[model samples]
Target: MNTNEYPTHRLVKSEDLNHHGTLYAGRSAEWFVESGFVAASSILNPKNIICLKIHGMQFRTPVKPGECICYTSKTVYAGKSSLAVYVKVARVSNLESIIVDGFITFVHVDEHTKACPHGIVIKPETEEEKLFYKRASELGR
Candidate 1:
């Protein structure tokens, strides 16, 4: 997938810093997974998807309260009913990048059986998608 094809969302009340201050890691994680789901669903079957797991996530900088946190996500690869999504969280103001990023993986399963089918349905539709596929491949996913 190309970089532009990645899905992105701005800050909302649900995504906020914890009582201890700074961004809540759990909220950030939830946003990341949700972003992943959005990206994957856009490419494949939206109704049948579920977040299977978060592979690796590292916070380089803390997102503070009232800051506009931006989450960008894209599908890196598709296998049958499953797709690996990579998400990046950053603080943006006047369009400046404040943080780097991380990733999450989601799977598409049968609504009833919850079993993953076997075949990539969403092929790269644009240059951005192709680029994401390349990047995901480089990461060994």
Candidate 2:
């Protein structure tokens, strides 16, 4: 993992499960946005950050109790007033096997809660990062 990628962990429990006895989508979504927010807030003021959109949620594996998962996110695209974050949910035991993956966008706001520029720019440095940046840039627009 690179420095840009932030990781958050969650331990599955009964309360976090669904009728099928796997982790609930609601709970998973909560963690998804929270970690995306962290990735955004890490570079900007948390008080000035607000989530704008969460798209492309892809759940590939069912999480069961006793399974530990990681939510790793990074700012893949940064615009004048917005950032598109990419988050991947994977079991700690197998990081390459994604359990879920998606994009979350956040906007920097002024004290009046109006969108404002954050004065940050992001450029992809690797081929993989370029792919992520391309996809995220499409979302930012």
Quote model 2's TM-score.
0.95
Please provide TM-scores, in order, for all candidate models, with all chains considered together. 0.73, 0.95
Cα lDDT tens digits, model 2, 12-122, are 999999999999999999999999999998889999999998999878878999899999999888888998899999999999999999999999999999999998888
Which sections of candidate 1 miss by over 4 Å? 1-7, 12-15, 94-100, 121-141
Candidate 1 local lDDT, 5-103, one digit each (tens): 454655635337677777778877777787777777776677777777786688777676667767777667766556778777776663456364655
> Candidate 2: worst 10 consecutive residues by lDDT?
1-10
Maximum-TM-score candidate = 2
Position 120, candidate 1: lDDT: 65
Q: How many residue pairs clash in each candidate?
A: 8, 0
Model 1 clashing-pair count? 8
Give the Cα lDDT of each candidate. Answer: 0.67, 0.91
RMSD (Å) per prediction: 3.6, 1.9
What is candidate 2's CA lDDT for residue 75? 89
In model 2, which regions exceed 4 Å deviation? Answer: 1-3
